[model samples]
Structure formats: structure tokens, C-alpha cells
Target: MLALASFISKHHPTLPITLISTADAASTPPSVTYRRLPDLAPPQPPIKNPVESFFETHRLHKPNLRAALVEISEKSRIAALVLDIFCNAAFHVSAALGIPTDFYVSNGSPGAAVFLNFPTMDETLDVDIGDMNDYLHFPGFPAIHSTPSKTVVFLCFGRRGLHSAEQLKETAVALERSGHRFLWSVRNPPGKGGDVPNLEEILPEGFLERTKEKGFVVRSWAPQSEVLSHEAVAGFVTHCGRSSVMEAVSSGVAMIAWPIDAKQKMNKVFLVEEMKAALPLDTGEGGLVTADELERRVRELMDATTGRAIRHRVAEMKASAAAAVGENGSSVLALHKFINDCCGRADG
Candidate 1:
């Protein structure tokens, strides 16, 4: 959401954006002022259903959000009130305030598709969600400095994917055994949020020294898109977050998809089965990939015939993505049409 606000502010400076979010973002642009809503209390009885829990939590914030919107609008006109895709509760509030509402789905079209179609799926499918396997519908370019590209695998789990110490050890050992160059971004495990990981404690002893020549571990975070576009990165071991998937596709880097969440699982199916641009990473108990399994998968991604096909497919996608964003391309034209349509409506 911050990214979108920043983009609009940069491109359309005349339109000042007042952002409403739960927390303060880092390095927020001056053009967009934050109108934060106080955090809501945790759902009572802890709703078991994620969908119900999500909506209920947001619904509780309607009063405060309404008050804020009303207050903000009194000072200046709100062109549109954009809600997070899950925050449908805000629609009524926005409507009452006579503010046009739009839902922002930060994750790309694949996530959006599954979310928008979920209602139909729930109504149609007789089987439980876990048992129903048949339907998974799925659908960033950074500048590069001139450097010779080499063969290196890039590994990054998304922000929400904090691996256990044992998982980290297995991943490190696997990268070492694979005998391939790699860049791994490691973070503190769950519950140790915000603390920088002590790499020495999380990984096997002497692992870094052994693989110093072939591997590098980035603590906390990595510049993923830039790294993916680097000449050395041949494949990505990803958690299949929508942004990561899009970046991989745009960079033409094939993947070893190991999804960490439900949304990502949907993306994995699309990448592995539908797009044929990635191979699935098999996880065992506790969702940990053993050293041998990880090593084999890495080798398969880098050297096998299937790996060749995956790479070829993603490379083609890269070309398609470039064309879509180019002058008068599909995305460009669609964006223009949307802008014109919105302007026409506003005029009326």
C-alpha cells in the first residue's frame, strides 16, 4: 500500500494522498500523509475460520474508521477511499460518507483471482477445502549495472516465512552439498520477530567458512529483485509470495517453489503446474526439507533437463512481461483505459 501511494504521489503530484494504515511505515513520502486507525483488539474467542476472523476484526474498526474519514473529509475532499481487499466492512462507511471506494489487493492477479472466485468455489465445491485439490487458479524489473552473469541460485522466503533453526541448518547444508553458488537470505525464526538473527547460532558451525567461496548468507533481508536480475543468479528458491513470483518471472529466473502460506500454495500450483516455470520443493515433517532433498532439488533446478525447460519457459515470460509494460502494451493500454473510464465517471 505504501508502494502504491508513493507511486501515485510521484507520478501524479497534484493529487495528494492521505493514507490510512495500522502502523507507521519507514521512509514514507512527504506527499502522502498518514491517517492511521488505531489497532483493533484481537478477535474474542479467537475465531477459527480465517475468513470470518479477518472480516470480524475489520468490522470492529468501522466506528473508528468512520470517525477518521468524516474528520478528514471535513478538512479536504477525498477523491476515493481505498480499502485493503479484505476490508469489505469499510464499504458501508465509505458509502455513507459519499466517498468512492476501491479495494487494493497488493498481491498480484493470481492472489486476486483466487480471492474473488473463492465465494463461487465455496458455494460449488461439496468437498472440504483440504480435500478439494482440483482448482487452483493462478495467474519487477530493476535496473542492472554491467556485470558478467554467473550461475548462482537465489534463496529467499517472504517476510512472513521465518524458518526454524533446524530448517535453516538444513538449507545451509543443502546449499553446501549442492556444490552450486547461492545467495540465501536468512531471518530470525517466528516469535523472535524484529531481532537480527545470530547467524552463528542459527546455522551449522563452520558452514559459512566451508561455503564462503560459493555461498553468501544475507541476514534479515535482501534486495531480492536486484539479486534476481543479477547475472550470477540462475534460479530462485522462493516461498512463492506474489511479489517474489512476479519478480522471478520478470527476471526470467526459474524457481524451486516452497510455499509457506495458503496464498502462496495457490501460487505454487500455478507456477509448477500451470506455468511450468518452476519445480516444487518437497517438504517433510514440520515442513522442513532435508539436506539431501534440498541438494537434489537444487541440482535439478540448475542442471537437469526439466530445469532447462523451466528456465526456457520463464525466459519467454520475461519477454512477455516486458512487452506488456512497454509503450502501448496490454498493461499500458489497459491502465490508460481505466484512467479514462474513471475520469469520465468522475466528470459525470
Candidate 2:
């Protein structure tokens, strides 16, 4: 959204723009005004699932969001409201006020494709998600600590997707069994949130010391971009978040695509099936990935023949991604055309 907003501002210096969100903006460009929505303090945890809870909480702000839209619309005409794909509720609000709307899909093309194909999926896969007795798994889909240069595997599940303590211990077991160097970033388990956990209290007894020579674990957060771009970094074990995927592609690292929830399953399909730059890990009963499968996937990423093929494909993609942002690239041209269209409509 920032990229599009920034480009729009640059193209039409006189255009007035305001960005509204539930969260405070950081480092917003001077050309754009950032307005934060009223705070709805996060739901106290031990919630069923973090992702669902997050969306539900945001949905509660619809009344306030409508007010914000009205307040802003009263001040100046909104040319077009470019909304995040998940925030579809705002479409009705904008339409009621006679404002044009467009969706901002940060997930890029593959994600866009999935969004377009939802009807097909619904028709083909007949399962009532709301009526399910057992957990409905949307399938692909951890943390790491350091910069180990092409030698260690990096694991991170996005902010709200952290696994349970029991699962983390299983993950530790998998890393130990895999016999590869690793960096694991520890966080409070999903739905089990309170405070950052003590490593000793959760991990398998002797797990840290046993892998001390080859592993590094840090609490809560790690410098993802810095670590992923490091020359020593090998492969990423990720939740297939769009941001993470883009970062990995730019760094030319193939991935172990593990889709946690929501739209990530589609991302895993795009990365593993279409892009062929990632490998998928299968989950077992209760959605827990066994140590054996985790170990195998890690090895698959490190296997010379298969690993080299994925790396070569990702490198080619990296080059193409670079070219797309270069002079006269498709993305640049598309953005220019979009701005012109929006401005043209605004003028009319």
C-alpha cells in the first residue's frame, strides 16, 4: 500500500492522501498522512487460535471504521479507497459514501490467483469449515537465531503462528535428528500466550546442550532480513507468509513451505507446485508434523541434487524479480498506468 501510495503521490504532487489503519504508522512517507483507528486492546489470550482472534477483533472495529471514513470523507473527497484484501468490510462503507474502491493485494500474483480461484476451490472441495467436528487443515505449511552462512537452516513461524511448547520440543527433536546446523527463535506458543517462555522450562531436557555445537536459539524475535540475506544462510523453514516469501526470493533462498492457516495454503501451492522453488512438509494426525517428516524435509532441502535444482530455480526467480523492479519493468509500468487511471477518474 505504501509503495502504491508513494508512487501516486510522486505522480500527482497536488493530490491529497490519507492512510487509515488500526495500527500506528511507522516511518510513513511525508507525502502521505497516517491516521490510526481507535484502539481495541488485543483479546486476552489462551484464545482458540491467534489468527481467528485477530480478525474477529478487527471486525469489531467496523462501526468505528465507518465513522472514520465518514469523518475523512467530510473533509475531502476520497478518490479511491485501496484496501487490504482481508478488510473487505470497508468496501460497503466506501460504496455507501459513493467512493470508488480497489483492493491492495500485497501477496503479489500467486496470492491474487488464489483469491480469484476461490469459487473453484469451494465447488471442488466440499467441506463445511464451520461445521467441521475436527480441525479443518488448509495445508502447505518456526524460529531461528543467528547468521550462520549457508550452513544452518532458519525457522520462523510468523508472529501469531507459534507452535505449542510440546510442539516446540518436537521441533527441537527434529532439528537434533536432522543433524544440520540451526538457528531457532523461541516465542510464546500460539493460543498459549502470556510472556516469552524460558528455554529450559519448555525444551526437551538436554536438547540445548546436545545441539549447542550446531544450534543457536533466541527469544521472541530475530533480525529476519539480516539473517536471511547472510551468505551463510542455507534454507528457510517458513509459514509461507507473503512478506517472508518475497524476502526469501530476493535473497535467492529456496524454502520448506509450511502453510499455517488462512491464505497460506495457497501460497504453499504456488511456491512448491507452481514455482518449484520450495518443498512441502506433510503433517500427521492432529496437524502435528512428526520428527521423522521434519528431518526428511530438512535433508531434502540440503540434498545436493534436489537442493541444487531448487536453488537454481530460486536464483532464476531472483533475477526475474530484480528485472521486474528495474527500468521499464512490468511492475513499474503497471504502477504508472494505475496511478494515471486513478487520477483520470478523480479528474472526471
Candidate 3:
């Protein structure tokens, strides 16, 4: 979101952009108008036990968001409203105000975007998402085939403590056993006291020293876009978050799908089955992925011939992604149309 907003602010300074998020004043960028919203779905309190907390928070935001929209519209000549796909409640507000609303999926994958529009597409095609062997087809893209060694980047889990301590420990053990060079972004568990936990206490003893030469574990936060853009990084072990998936694709990196929550599982399906841009890890049994299995999968992705093919396909998609956002690109043309349609001019 920041990247897109920054680009617009830099290229079209006259156009105003307002960002409605739970981010605080310090975190919000100066390029955009930031409306402070209560973070009902905070990272603390471990939002795992009762999944309703997440939904309830979104429901709670409806009234406040509606008021904010109405207030903003009254202050300015609103052209159009762009919203995250999950912000369905806000759609009603836009409709009530007779304003046009555009849903931003934020993944930037044409294949994934098309998959989301499947309902509007021909309903005759029977694409079995459960079958990895089945070829899922989309318009404007070549047939996606399974490939075999792409360098792997592993993200332990999402921000909301979806994984248990045992699962995290198992992930650490797998990374060690894989013997592959990696960058792991590790975060403190939800509900933990103020201080960040020591790496020794969290990971296996001697784990850091053993992998010091090849692996880097970043506690709290890591510059994900920078890390993924590195030439050495070829694939991602991710939770299938939209932004992360788009970043991986834009950087020509393949994936090992390990979706943890929400629409992530659906995104994983798009990457693994629809787009064939990823390999899926099985966590259905016991919910604990053994070190041996992790090592095998890592080796297959990093050292196998099939991994090379996957990397090649991902490179092609990277070119497509770049072209889509380039001058006179599909996304560029769409933006122009949207501006002209909403504001009655392309200058806005």
C-alpha cells in the first residue's frame, strides 16, 4: 500500500490520497493523509483461540469507517473509493453515498486476480483445486506445470500467533536439517511480555552458532522486499499474504505455500494449483511438519531439476508482472480509465 501510495505521490503530487488504517501517527507516511482507526485486532491477546475476534473487529470498524468516509466526502469532492477486498462492510457505505468503489486485491498477480473473478467467468470449466496434478488454466497465461531446485525463503507464520510453540520449534529444526542458506523473519509470540524473547530460549541450543555462516534469523521485523529482491533468493516459504505473494512474484521467486490464516489459504490455492507457481507443504496430518520432511522439500526446491523449471516459469511471470505496470501497460491503462471515468479527466 505504501509503495503504490508513494509512487502516486511522487508522480502525481496534485492528487490527494487518504490512507485509512490502524497505523499510528509515527508509522503513517507524510505523503498521504492518515486517518487513525482503533486497532481492535491487535497482535497481542493471541487471536487464535476465538477466531471471532478477527471478524468482530472488522464488524466494529464499519460504523467508524462509514463516518470517516462520509466526513471525508463532505470535505472534498470525492472521485472514487478504493478499498481492500476484506473491507466488505465499507462497500455498503460507498453505495449509500452513491460513490463508485474499486476493490483492490493487492496481490498484483493477473492469474490470481482472474481466479478471484472466476464467478463472473464461464462456469462450465471444472477446475479441481484439490488436485495438484490437474492443470488449472487462465486466460493470457501459458499452461502452468510443476517444476523442481529454486532457492527458498521461509516465513515461519503470520503476525497473529497462528502457530504453536511446538510448531515454531519444529520449523527451526527443519531449517537446520535442510542445510540450506535462508533468511528467517522471526517475531515474538503474541501476549508475551514487553521484552523480546532471547533467541537461545526460543530456538534450539547452538542453533544460531551452527547456522551463523549460512542463515540469518531476524527478530521482530525484516526488510522483506529488499531480502526477496536479492539475487540469491529464488523461492518463498510463506503464509500466502497478498503483499508477500505479490512481492515474491514481482521478484521472480517461486514459493512453498504454508498458508496459516484467513484468505491466505485461498491465495495458496491460486499459487499452487491455479498458477502452478508454488509447491504446497502438507500440514494436515498432526499439524507438525517433521524436520526430515522439511529437509527433503528444501533440497527438492533448491537442488532438484524440477526446481530449475519452476524458477524459469517464475522468471517469465516476473516479466509479465513488470510489463503490466510499465508504460502503456494493462495496469497503467486501467488506472487511466478509472481516473477518467471517476474524475471526468485523466489528470486527476
Candidate 4:
């Protein structure tokens, strides 16, 4: 939200802008004053319960957040609390203080779709989430086509401590040998030659160079929004993080969910079976996929008939997302409402 904060500051300089972050982020930019809070660390192997996870993260930082709130509430005439929906404690804090609050789903439409319970692909034991079977069968959405078969695609792992290097390599090799074109965003950490082997060295020999044309391998942080918006990007292999989900839906991209941490699994369920815009991958025992299986699925998804249908549906979804945020759009109206409600006037 730093980008949003910056935009707001530039557009409305008279508004007092104090950003609350962790102590590590105390050296924030000049336009915004930084109030340091505590940091949060997640559990190893990660937990599946979203409620439990939320409390744990907040517990680490709540004391500092409360202190910041106390100071702000006492000194300034606070207007409104605009918060990310995932930031669970913000709502309660604002309510306790009787401040008007607006929840912002930073991840956008796809993220919002999950929250709203859009229809999704069906799941059976052993088999991963298949391609879109129908037009998601949701209200306000037109009937779109679904693919028959899909690849056993696994997306990028977020900072949720989900997939290990061993697992990533294992999957990559399987896909490569299977003749399946895998599109992956493999970000290499800073510095070379260390305790952990880099992704470049971990894959099978000639794995990347051979599949250079077929597979899309982005080495650094990709312009995810743009990539998802591309025609070639038929299925999204995502960590099922809110931001990624939003980008995919906003761009009309389908998904292959492999939620790592946070409320990702919840998001996975919402998308795969609920939203119908994506399929789910198994976080099964061994967490390994064979090359033959990977190839069969990837070919199934990329086939002419399957790819074409998904493309059309995604195109429609793209329009809906655009409309949602367009001028006088739903999200725009919501923003206006929030502004008016908070400031008591549009001009403010």
C-alpha cells in the first residue's frame, strides 16, 4: 500500500499522513512520517487455520500498534481508518475508538471474487484441480467455457515458508521432462554461492536452455499484472496470495492454486471450487509430481480447444474487472462513498 499512500499524499497534501510500520521500516520516505511497530514471524510448516494465523500475527505487533493508535487518537482529530481486509485487528481497534473504517481489498477483483464466493472448479481425491469446467455459474457473470484437461502446474511460492528448494526443483524437472511448458517466476535471492543452491543450478541439466522457447522463465520479480494480462498466459500457477489472485482476476487470467501461508488455503478453496476461475494443486505427501503426469496435464490445458475457451472466459472477466474499477465504476463509487463518509464532504 506504499504506492497508494504515496498517491494519496501527492493528491491530498493537506491530509495528515502518518504511516504505521515495523521498526525495521522506520527509515521511510519523506512524504510520510513513519511510526514503528513490532514485526511478526510465522510458524514453520505453516498452519492451515486462518483465524489462528491472524491472531498470532497481530499478537506480535498489537502492543506497538495500540501505542501508535493511542498517540494518534489523543493528539489528532482522526478522520477514518482505511485498512486491508487481511489486517484483522485494525477493524476492532477502529471500532473500539468509534472511528469510521473502510476495508480495502488490496488484491483487487480476483481477491474480491473469492471473498464474494464465486463458483469454481470441482475437485476429486488424487487428481489436481482441472481446468475451468463452466462459466463459473456465478451471478452477474456470463456463461464462459471450461477446459477439459489441465497440467499439474505449480505456481511460485510466496514468503509464506511453503515450498522448499528441493520441492521446487523436483516439480520443475518433472514438468520439463514431461514436455510441459511451465511458466514460473523464480526470483533468486541476493548474493551467490552460499549455503543454499540457486534455482539456476538446482534444475536438471539443460532444463532451462532447452525449454527456453516453450517455457517462460522470469528470473526476477515480474510485472505480474502485465504477464497475467498476456494472451499466452492461459493458466496461472500462483501461491494463491491475495495480491496475486487480484492481479490474475483483474487481468482475466485463470489459476492453478498452491497457497503457501496466510489465508491462502482459504483463498484456494474460494477460487478453485467456488470461483471457477482456477484449479487447485495438491499439497500431497512427498509434494512431488512425475514427469509423465505433468506432461499429460500441461498438454491438456494448452491444447487448442481448451486454451481458446479459457481465453474467451478470461476476456469477459477482464472486462468485468475493468468495469469494477473504471470511471463511475463500483469500486470507484465505493471509494467516493468512503471519502465522503470519512471527510463528510467530497471536496475534503
Candidate 5:
């Protein structure tokens, strides 16, 4: 959102941009005005489950968001209301005020976005998503294949307690066994008594020393976009989160899909089955992905034949994505139409 606001300010200096959210905007750009909303929901306890916490916060933010929209609209004329897909509550406010509205899917893939709409579209297809052999083909996209590249970045979970301690331990062991140069961003799990532990305490003893030359384990948040853009990063092991997928695609990095949540599972299907831009990792019997499997997949993704083919395919997607956002591109034209519709004229 900040990036978009910065771009608009550069191209259209007279236009005003306002950001409304519960997050602190202490480091926001000068061109953007940040409006903090009051918390209407009760204070939440320390989050133990990241997925459940996300939904809980979303539900709590709805009433406060509606109130903020009302206040903002009354204070100034809102030409158009742009909202994230998760914040569907604001749609009601937009409709009530008769304001134009558009949803922003944080994921960069328009194909993935369209695939998500399939459930709401015609229901006659009758394809089982659980079947690994069942292939999905999107219009104007190549057939999906299970292939990826050499150097990989495993970030299936964010800097929070998304995975269990056992899962984290297994992941550390897998990275150590893979023998591939990797950058793993790991966060401490929610403490038993609200006290976060050091990396050494959280991970296996001597794990860092053993892999220090071959791997980089980041304890806090990582600059994901910057890291993906690096030339050495050829493939991504991701949870298929929207923003992470967007960063990977925009950077032209292929993926090893290891979806952990429902929405991420959908995204994995679109990328791996519908677009062939990624390889799917199979958890062994009873869905337990052993270190041996992880090591083998890493080697396959970094091998000469399979990895090279996936890189070629991803390069094509990168070019197409770039073209779509370029001058006179489809995305550029759509933006023009949206702006014209909302503001009625460039001057507004």
C-alpha cells in the first residue's frame, strides 16, 4: 500500500492518499496520511495459534473498520474505496455510501486470483482438489508441472508461531540434511510462560555451527522481497501466502509448495497444478514430511535437468508479469480505467 501511494505521489503529485488501519504508521511516507482506528474488540490474549489469531483479529477489525469508513467519508469526499480481500466488511460501507470499490489481492498472480473465483463460478466442473493426479489448466496459461530450481528459500511460515515446535525441529533437521545453501527465517515459538527463548535453545544444539557455512537462519523478520530478487535465489519453499507468492512470482523464482493453511492450499493448487510454476512436496505416510524426503526434493530441485526446465518456465512467467505492468500494459490500462471511473476525470 505504501509503495502504491509513493508511486501515485510521484506521478500525480496533487492526489491525496489516506491509509486506515490498526497498525502503527510511524514510518509511513510523508505523502500518505495514516488514520488509526480505535480498537472495538476486547484485548486479545497472547496468541498461541497464528492461523486462529489471524481470523480472530479479522473479525474484531470489522466493526471498527466500518466506523472508520463512516468517519472518513463524512470528513472528506472519498472518490473510491480500495480494500483488501480479507476485509469484506468495508464492502458494505462502500455500497451504503455508493462509493466505487475494488478488491486488492495481495498476491501478484492474476491467474491465481481468477482460480480462487472458480468456486463462486459455475460448479459443474466437479474436479476433486485432493487428488494429486487431477490437473487444472487455466485459460491463457501453460500446463502445470512439478518442477523447480537449484538454490531454494524455505519460508512456508512467517515470523510467528504458525508451525508447531516439532514441525520447526523437523524443518531444522531437514535443512541440515539437504546440504543446500539456504536462507531460513525462523521465529521463536510462543513460550510456555510468555517468555521467548534464544535461537540456540529453540533449535537443536550445534545446528548453527554445523550449517553455518551452507545455511543462514534468520531469527527475526526477513526482507523477503529483497532476498527473492537476489540472483542466487532460484526456487522458493513457501506456505503459499498471498504476499509471499507475489514476491516470488514478481522475482521470477519457482517454488516448492508446502501449504500450511486453507487459503495457502488453494494458492498451491493454482501455482503447482494450474500454472506449473512450482513443485509439490509430498509428506510421507500420515502427512509427516521426514528429513529424508526434504533432502531428496532439495536435490531434485537443484539438479541439472529438472531444475533447469523449471527455471526456463518461470523465466517466461517473469517476462509476462513484467509486460503486464509495463507502459501500455494490460494492468496499466486497467488502472487507468479504474481511476477514470472512480474520479470521473484525471483532475479529480
Candidate 6:
């Protein structure tokens, strides 16, 4: 958003901008001045996945936002209102005020297409998502395969967070001897009892030392788009989070699905059974996978020949994704049409 805001300011300097966010969002990047609005204080007990939780929490600043919008519209004639797809409630306010609005799912277009196709997916495949063999022939343009070892693995949780401290220590240990290159996000290491712990103290002893050259541990919130686009990322080990899925597909990276909680498990099943774009790791219900399981799975994805083939197919999908946002890209056309209808013209 900062990037987009900066681009708009630089390329269209005359255009007035009013940035809005929760009070908590007020911080650096002081260049883009904003009108802080009333945003719900996040829940006292942090939800495991805040985004999902936020949607569940119906409390909104729309009334306050409406007043602000009305004020702004009165002065400058409000044009287009671009909103995140998950914020469905925004439509009500926009509709009430007769304001034009367009939804933006920053993830790739493929994810959006898949989300729309959910209702049409075969109901017979609704059972618990089985192993790679059970899903190797799943539906969709990109096919799946049963491979042995893999080269690169992309890791991120659907909820965007670290696993338990014990889980991380175990994973680090397993990766040390596996000899496979990994691109994992330990963005924030698990803290002790309640708060975030000092990362150095939490990491398994000598874990970083051993994997120093072969692995990359992102200690900060990652620029996922940039990382996925990097050539070294061959296959993504993901929780099938919509955003991650979109980013990976946009970059044409194969997947190894290891979904944890809500929506994710469902998304994984779809990708493996209906999308045929990924391999789902098996973990019996509520039985947390051991380090050995993670190691074996990672090795299979990185070194297997079939896994290499999956990577190739993913590359093709990546091209398709790029085209969707390119010159005549679906997203590009959509934006153009939106601008024409709301802002008056593309040139404007």
C-alpha cells in the first residue's frame, strides 16, 4: 500500500490522497499523510490468525468511515473505492452512499478464480484429503505428480506465523542433515509463555550455524511476492493460505500443502484434489507431525524427479498468472473498466 500510495503521489501528483487506517497503523512512511479513523481495538487475546478473526469480528469503523467519506466526497467528488475482497461489509456502505467500489485481492488472479469455482467443485471429493497418490490426478489445468526428492521448498503458514517453539527447534534440526535448500519464514520466532522471545535464545543451538549457507530464514515479515518470484524457489511448502497460494501461483511455484487450522485444511484439499496444483502432506487428525515426517516430506519434494516436473508445470501457470496482470491482463482490464466507470477515464 505504501508503494501504491507513493506511486500515485509521484505519477499523479495533483490527485488528492487521504490515507486511512486504525490508530495502530499510524507509524513511519511519514510521507503519505493520513486521517486516522476509528478502528476497532484488536481483541484482547490475539487470535491465531488475525485476518480471519477480524472478519469474524463484525465490529467495524464503517459508520465513522462513512462520515469521513461523505466529508471527502462533498469536497472532491469521491470517485472509485477500492477495497479488499474479504472486507465484504464495505460494500454496504458504498452501496448506501452510491459510491463506486471495486474489490482487490492482491494475490494472483488464479486464487480468485479458484475461490469463485469452489461451489462447482465435485462434492464426491469432499472426504478427508488423502496422500499424494490419492490426489496426483486432481482436477485443473496444472497436473500433479508423485515424485521423490525436490530441490527448493517455499514455506509459509496460512495464518502467517511460526509453529510452536518445539516445532521450530525440531524442524531446524531435521533440515540440518537433509541437505535440501529451504526458503522458510521464521519471521518471528515463538516467544516464551506469552510474549515474543529473543530470537537468538529461542533458536535451536547451532541450528543457524549448520544451515547458514544452505538455508534462508526470514526473520522479518517477508515481501512474499519478491521472494516467490526469486529463481531459487522451486516448490512452496505452504498452509494453502489464499494469499500465499496466489503469490506462489503468480510466480509459478509448485506446492507442498501442510495446512494447520480452519479454511487452510479446506483450501489444501481443494488444491490437491480439485486444483491438481499441489501435494498435501499427511498428518493424522490432531496428531502434530514429527520432525522426521517434515524431513522426509521436504526431501521428497526437493529431490524427486516427478517433483521437478510439477515445478515445470507450475512455471507455466506462473506465466499465465503474469499474463493475467500484464498489458491486457484480466486484472488490468478489470482495473481499466473500473476506472472508466468510476474515475471517468484510464488516462485520468
Query: Backbone clashes per model, in order?
Result: 3, 16, 7, 13, 3, 10
lDDT of each: 0.82, 0.79, 0.71, 0.62, 0.71, 0.68
| Tens digit per residue, CA lDDT, model 3, 1-348 | 666667778888878888887567534346678787766544545456466765656667877777788889888977888877667677877898888998777776764656575785345333433212223345664444322323445564546534555666888888888777888887655455543556787788899999998788877566778878877676688888889888989988878888777699899899988887888887747666666666666766765345655666677788999999999999999999987798865445
Candidate achieving the largest TM-score: 1
**Model 5, TM vs. native:** 0.53
Q: Which stretches of candidate 6 lie over 4 Å from their true place?
A: 1-151, 158-160, 187-200, 284-287, 333-348
- 17-67 per-residue lDDT for model 6 (tens digits): 666555555542435567767655663455689886787543366777688
Arrange candidates, best lDDT first.
1, 2, 3, 5, 6, 4
Error of 2 at 342 (Å): 1.5
* lDDT string, candidate 1, 173-192, tens digits: 89998898899999998766
On lDDT, who's better, 2 or 3?
2
TM-score between model 6 and native: 0.49
Clashing residue pairs, candidate 1?
A: 149-231, 150-231, 150-232
Q: Number of the top candidate by lDDT? A: 1
Those runs of model 1 whose alpha carbons end farther than 4 Å from true positions after fitting are 1-148
**Least accurate 10 contiguous residues by lDDT in model 6:** 126-135
Give lDDT tens digits, candidate 2, residues 258-338: 789979999999999899989999988888888888889998896644476787778788888898889998889999999
Please provide, for model 5 over 36-63, each residue's C-alpha lDDT reduced to its tens digit, 9 standing for 90 to 100: 8786546678678987776667667767
What are the per-residue Cα lDDT tens digits for candidate 4 across 1-348?
576677788888777777775535644346677666755445434669988866667655666666678889898877887776667676777787788888778887765654554333233211123334332333344333333333323346554333455565666765676565466766543343443445567666677788786576655455667766665456677878888888888866666666666598899888767666665565446655444444444555555454445445565777888999999999999999997898875456
- lDDT, model 5: 0.71
Q: What does the lDDT read for residue 63 in candidate 1?
A: 89
Candidate 2: 10-residue stretch with minimal lDDT: 137-146
The residue pairs found clashing in candidate 6 are 149-302, 149-303, 149-304, 150-301, 150-302, 150-303, 150-304, 151-302, 154-237, 191-197
Off by over 4 Å in 3: 1-158, 345-348
